[model samples]
Target: MHGRCISCRFFANDPALIEATFPGLNVLSSAYGSVRSDAGICSRHEFFLSSWQRCRDFESGDNEGKDALLPVEKKLIGYSIGFGAVLLGILVWISYTFFPTGH
Candidate 1:
């Protein structure tokens, strides 16, 4: 398997974006070429695959009909935000326990 199966999750359905990101790969004619098909790997496992390979049990497009790729910056931002929230919550709890409002 050249890892170009249509059912593969790494398959790029968005020709324009995929071509731009992977200039070396043929986004239009290769078996792994973008079909604009909905099929793809599950969301949970999508991040684990190499951009060059396709998943075996790919399902048709996402419900939003968009490629499931998430920008690295966006992911990082989300992580940072979540971490900050957790830290803040911990600090609030520590302060509440050590310094009661009545005292």
Candidate 2:
């Protein structure tokens, strides 16, 4: 058993990972920010838990795996933002052309 959920294999608190796993969590709510400080999902238990919570079935994950996945997640986020920006620009242009305000 792990002393805390943060160190457990099932706990996923990394900001990039969280954002990648649940699209729009960062925009809709503070998943990694202080508003949910160190809280993450416990996949084994199927619960949203704080870092300090203890788990009886805790298993140490290969921390290196977590680190390795970070770069990929970050890239995904970057691409998503870039795509969103392009889409938004297109929508704005369409709106302005179709329903231009008197100026």
Candidate 3:
């Protein structure tokens, strides 16, 4: 059995990303926290597993459909932008109404 979970292929659906980040996870994927922070459903164990987790049932899997996905971060970024825009609009309206120019 491979000592490292990353070598077991069950490590990540997108194994390439895991491999690339394994060397320098601290510098590359710092925004998402640790490399192991990424979690996915492990087919072998029929449960979720972190990228850094290892198990006896680990087996090689393909990465055809799997992608280096970051859905949560994407959604959060979208929501933040939307909320900021709304706040900026409100600020502009408030300033215009309270500080009307003398015409």
Candidate 4:
């Protein structure tokens, strides 16, 4: 038995994380974005594997015991929040226009 692949720096389980790490990959080939769920690429070995899969060459990605979000992921979350705020504003405007609170 070996350590989990997710703990390896070479393994990237999230498709968005993978795409962000390897920019323009999707443009080069859409197939790269179609990996199965919980599956990630082993950049060192050049193969895709599930997150739960084990490897003998397991090494910490220097982020032991830390659940830090990647910079790109942080930006993505910010963008999502901003979009949600804008959407909420639009919905409130529509509601106020269509339905009045005080008759």
Measured by TM-score, the strongest candidate is 2
| lDDT of predicted model 1 | 0.52
Worst 10 residues of 4 by lDDT: 29-38
- After TM-score superposition, the amount by which residue 37's alpha carbon in candidate 3 deviates from its true location, in angstroms, is 16
Measured with C-alpha atoms, the lDDT of residue 24 in candidate 2 is: 75
Pairs clashing in candidate 3? none
**Error at 85, model 3, angstroms:** 0.7
Q: All candidates: CA RMSD in angstroms?
A: 14.0, 7.4, 10.0, 5.8
TM-score on alpha carbons, each prediction: 0.30, 0.49, 0.34, 0.48
Writing each residue's lDDT as its tens digit, candidate 3 over 1-103 gives 4343544555454545545535675465542445545565454566546556667675655433446658998899999999999999998888889877832
Candidate 2: lDDT over CA atoms? 0.77
**Would you list the C-alpha lDDT of every candidate in the order shown?**
0.52, 0.77, 0.60, 0.76
Q: What tens digits encode model 2's per-residue C-alpha lDDT throughout 7-93?
A: 778888877776777777778785657887877888997787788888679787644234455787989999999999999999988
Q: Model 2: which residue pairs collide?
A: none
What pairs collide in candidate 1? 8-54, 8-55, 9-55, 38-60, 38-61, 39-59, 39-60, 39-61, 40-59
- 2 against 3, candidate with superior TM-score: 2
lDDT tens digits, residue span 81-102, model 4: 9999999999888888888774
